[model samples]
Target: AQSVTQPDIHITVSEGASLELRCNYSYGATPYLFWYVQSPGQGLQLLLKYFSGDTLVQGIKGFEAEFKRSQSSFNLRKPSVHWSDAAEYFCAVEPSNTGKLIFGQGTTLQVKP
Candidate 1:
């Protein structure tokens, strides 16, 4: 079984400030991890993914994440936030073969100018 947990329900960051969103997961083995962003009234867009090799993966919109197997965590980060970055972020895990994903509760980011 695979599960994701995003501890923060909401977060506020000033425009141009650095941001980091925490995520944790539990699975039977090494699972595929991903980060997705969904703006209001919009569909989820894949931010980044970790399947193998490099622990650090770069994503679109200047976002990146690192998979820490020891900690069972994959945290998303951005060097600078923008007002347009406000949205709901979800961390998900794929158990493979099931073609399904277990998603976290989601963290809503509010960027203030």
Candidate 2:
């Protein structure tokens, strides 16, 4: 079975600063990852995904992720943070295209001025 882990349960970032959310997966083969963000009262929105080809994947809202096969990591990075960016970020993996997604516990982003 495949699983995802978000080491940081919560992260505080200053507004206008850079942000990086860690995501690591445990799988025997190359697995795809999707990053989703959920606002306070909204459904999950797809930020970015990694299927194949380029290791560096670009996402919406000025976000990008790098797929590091050696490290088994697909970390999400934003050059700068915004106050509106504060939300619950989730890292999900689809096991064998089963239509079932294994998601991390989720990381809450708190932005400060």
Q: Local distance difference test, per candidate?
A: 0.95, 0.94
CA shift of 54, model 1, Å: 0.5
Q: Clashing residue pairs in candidate 2, if any?
A: none
Residue runs of model 2 more than 4 Å from their true location after superposition: none
State the TM-score for model 2.
0.97
User: Could you give candidate 2's per-residue lDDT for residues 7-113 as a string of tens digits?
Assistant: 99999999999999999999988877899999999999999999899999999999999999999898999999999999999999887777778999899999999
Give candidate 2's root-mean-square deviation (CA, Å). 0.7
| Top model number, lDDT | 1
lDDT (tens digit, per residue) of candidate 1 on 1-113: 56799999999999999999999999878899999999999999999999999999999999999999999999999999989999999999988647699999999999999
> Model 1 segments beyond 4 Å from truth?
none
- TM per candidate comes to 0.97, 0.97
